[model samples]
Target: MLEAARTTPTALWNDSSDLSELKQSIAFGGVGATCNPVIAYSTIKKHLDVWRPRIEAIAAANPTWGESQIGWQAVRDMSVEAAALLKPIFDEHNGRNGRLSVQTDPRFHRDAKALADQAVEFHGLADNIVVKIPATKVGIEAIEDATYRGVSINVTVSFSVPQAVQAGEAIERGLVRREAEGHDVSRMGPVVTLMVGRIDDWLKHVVARDKLFVDPSALEWAGVAAIKRAYEVFQARGLRSRVLSAAFRNVLQWSELIGGDLVVSPPFKWQEIINASGYDVVEKINEPVHEHYLEELNRIPDFRKLYEVDGMTIEEFEDFGPTRKTLRQFLEADADLDALVRDILIPAP
Candidate 1:
């Protein structure tokens, strides 16, 4: 399944200042491009002197577009250009591979309908575009609704098994719904992104940074264990959601999760994975998304609804409070929460 994935690197790391270097990376093996508008906004803003003419041309041609429209237009244009550069691979793979990903603004991460709308709009901009979304409650809902319409989704920001499970189930549900409604399920192309390194970085506060290097085997093993569990959930559910590990900070985590059905790696990590040795297949455990999931799914509180403050918009994300809270409660009743959260939250990125 990993082999079938469109192994694209995040374009955020690409040298926008040097188109040649960016093009070279794309040409080498990147089948897709990933970007968040905020990141794009920042990057393009930094290079606006070099970008103004292009934006001006687009705005000049369109005329009615506003400043925000122009900015997003530039983003779409770059994404489309990057997608076009990868068009051959997209065409060669016959649409199963070589797609580009653009995330909806983080501001609306919890708004299902808004995300669904973005999926439709973004899909119109590029044929190979995969609308990136978080693996949150509403995000999953958005994924389902979008999938029903045949939009590709890359579920991102996942930090735990439950989140990963939600992504897989959402994919299967979307597939089932589409099939029921007489839409083609095969074309929807769903991918689940499991973040690895962010959890490690968070854990650095708890564990000595030097310990990560001192007992490299221990740190590495914990990450692999988390990924192995995630894969186990993927296989158990028998859902078609392609697992795409993200937030990769180094080559080792890439090695651990390379068995994922798909992987959206950062550029630095992409280079590491591309250059790493011993990419091998591993065993998958039998686990299914069960009725028990409905409990958590129902308990999946609306983070956005809870925190409506303009600045604290995304605080309502399940990962921010409910998910972590549940995990905390469980760990308190069980064993070491610190150890488990470190493994689960910071799997290996």
Candidate 2:
């Protein structure tokens, strides 16, 4: 893994804001790190000894701020600390790598203006901060809006080829607008995350619900194939936004997407496992998926939505099975974070 980090054009990213984990990933050549609501909540949940006092202090410092505000401030603090670790790499690699992605409030998914407004604030937190905006219908609008305003964005809650393509297009429009207005667009590094593993999970749900005859073992290849398909589309369209492989369920989730100018972000433990495996880091970015797996996966409609570029229309993005599910999950994570902070503010008997 270390050798591949040094040798391959592909970049490794840590899907955590944990300082210790970030340090480990940095040693392994990971240039980027990210935190969404679920990740941020988990970060605090796992480190109560360290974060509990900080949460109490934040609440005390801002008496008027509610639990949500205090909780988000904690997320911001984590992002800033993580971004500090990646600052050197950010300078060395320019803006394409070395970013700390911070997600906006998931409750604002329907409000593009609210999302972009929060994005502006998050971008101000650090030079290397990459704001995450979900790929809802309004989110496409917000992506362009935030890009024009100079916020480097990572499209989240996305799980389809159409979502990736539309996201790239939205980003292109934003960059073009910036170029037209004479704003510097060079330092802005935008990405569209294909939560490949989540898509696989969604397909599994479909299989169980519909009792599909799809080969169960072959289902593992679904995400790899989906990303490959999205990457092919990104290549053909000459998209500036790179497709990122996130939400790791297996080694192939990151390993198969390795190579090219793209990013493969797995959790710290997954990185440990991948490194221990001593997997040869090969350039399989352009490798074709097996025809048999594709045929078997094509049996499921949800898989078709993920595999085909035109599977879901723009109007269908928010309601798409996986998108809806992920958005709800993120929102729940937000609520969970608030509850944690609420406990700190008003401890129960």
Candidate 3:
């Protein structure tokens, strides 16, 4: 699989905070992991026995910290532990793989300075950590500022070619700035995370509601098509930032993007399916966007504008279909975590 004609893709675990699961994933060929608010909340709830002592220690030290701060601290500790486990892989790959992502509070997604500050703090947790920043209008600026400050970043919530292109350009701009300041550009790491599955899910609902007809075959391939288009744009731009294909929903999405210079963070179920298939040969399935589907999608002006362009103004990128929805989801997750911490956990402060 590694010696095939196409690029050998790296596998990254999609969840964080389970040591046993993390070890299992690593043994099953995963080199990294991603941490999000929902995962963090789940970890806290399920592993209370494991995290209780640490949470108590944090509360004891802070004395007056609120639920939000304490919740994030727990998240930081779990992410750091995950990063420690992946550090050797990171070292071996020269900082390209073995990344453990720690996401910032989504409430701060619109604040560039706060996001940058949170990223810097997360970077301080471990050397193998990549701070996950939302691909919002201010997020691009935050990515640029964080990269310029020598921080590795994973620009999350990207759903279109324009968002991915803007993210890559932001990282490039930051690297250039860092180089001007005498920092080594080779050490900086940035990944633009293009979400699959969700695009198709959204389009499915839209088609169902509006009763606009399109080829069902083309609808099934919408997610993969979006990813392929994003990959093409990334290649044409010649940017240094890597592309991380995330939010996969099925086996076909996994098999189709087999050989690419991208990181795939498929959920545990999909990973199991791939492992059971015993697939050893790598095949390149980079098909062009389906014409009929593209035409159908173009009926929605926003979808067409974003799909056709490689780049867009920051305003357009923020208002793009999945970006807004994904950010709200993250914020809701953060809020849910806060509620859980306040209502259930009684850390002595």
Candidate 4:
């Protein structure tokens, strides 16, 4: 399965600013990339000399623009460069591979119209660019609107099976609408990101604080189990949206889901570990969640909803574990980038 996956392309989850790293990832079977504010900010900071002129030019043209706006413009420029690097691969794969995702601002996560409009703007950055949308309630609506308008989207911040279902539905709805209007749906690309690691990270903290008697092994498998179950949901629904296995914590998390239709975006270090391990069999790791793990997870009211794909309302999906925390983290990173931009654009006189 690994070899077969090799024949196809995989995506890397990192900043696109580093040309050497991006090329290395492509050489190691990475066909695409994902970018966020953290990456955009870090890249700008690292290559101040390279980006300083661009920011200065923008500042001169829009003197009335604030620091945040100027800073985000730099990020947009970086995103365009990254997309250009992957354009050939995207063309070669005919839109399946060689796609780049740039996330919308977290502040508009709950505004569907804003997200859709922003998505269209990001799409204009490059042909290979896929606007990243958070899978919040409004975000799903935005996904539908963007898809309807022929914009590709990468749905992020999704943790639950129901959330995944909603995103898939939105994508499908948009595709159908496009099809009705005589637009081809073959080139449309959308991926629902199912975050791993963070789920177990949250569970571990809960177990320690609550002094729960849950088995340690069970905790270890929580993240993987949730992801596999979500994959099962995707498979069962036959949704067009692909599953992106993201935020991996270890090699097992990378190795476990090799044979499925999902695309795994392992971090740079984790990718190195997988390459070093030299494991080469693509087998299904989509086994049922361990009975003990499920039982223990059921003890927590919040986790119980996450453990199973059903029984959670749309409202519950937004308030569930990992969802709120992930959004908060994104917001914090956005603020950090905003501050970094402010300092760069308007230095202390």
Candidate 4 regions exceeding 4 Å error are 1-4, 7-17
Could you give me the TM-score of model 2 versus the true structure?
A: 0.98
The local distance difference test score of each candidate is 0.55, 0.90, 0.76, 0.76
Model 1 Cα lDDT, one tens digit per residue, 1-349: 1331334222122212123434665544555555544445555655657676776676678777555555566667777777776667668766666677776655565489998888889888877777877767788788888887788888766655556666678778877887888776555556776555554443433345323223333333333344456676677668776666555566555544443454545553365445454454332222222334322222222311221222122333465533354334422322232222233323577
Q: Point out where model 2 deviates above 4 Å.
A: none
State residue 346's C-alpha deviation in candidate 4, in Å: 2.9
lDDT of 4 by residue, 197-221 (tens): 7777888888888888777777767
Ranking by lDDT: 2, 4, 3, 1
CA RMSD (A), model 1? 12.5
Please state the error at residue 78 of candidate 3 in Å: 0.4
Candidate 1: worst-modelled 10 consecutive residues by lDDT: 303-312
- Candidate 4 least-lDDT 10 residues: 8-17
Report per-prediction Cα RMSD to one decimal: 12.5, 0.9, 2.9, 2.3
Angstrom error of the Cα, residue 174, model 4: value is 1.1
User: Candidate 1: deviation at residue 173, Å?
Assistant: 0.7
Candidate 3 lDDT by residue in tens digits, 131-250 = 898877899999999999888999888777778888888999999999998888675567888777777777776677778767666666667776777777788878888787778776
Q: How many backbone clashes can be found in candidate 3? A: 0
Backbone clash count, each prediction separately: 12, 0, 0, 1
Clash pairs detected, candidate 4: 1-282
Residue pairs clashing in model 3 are none
Two-way lDDT contest, 1 vs 2, winner:
2
Higher TM-score: candidate 3 or 4? 4
TM-score of 3: 0.91
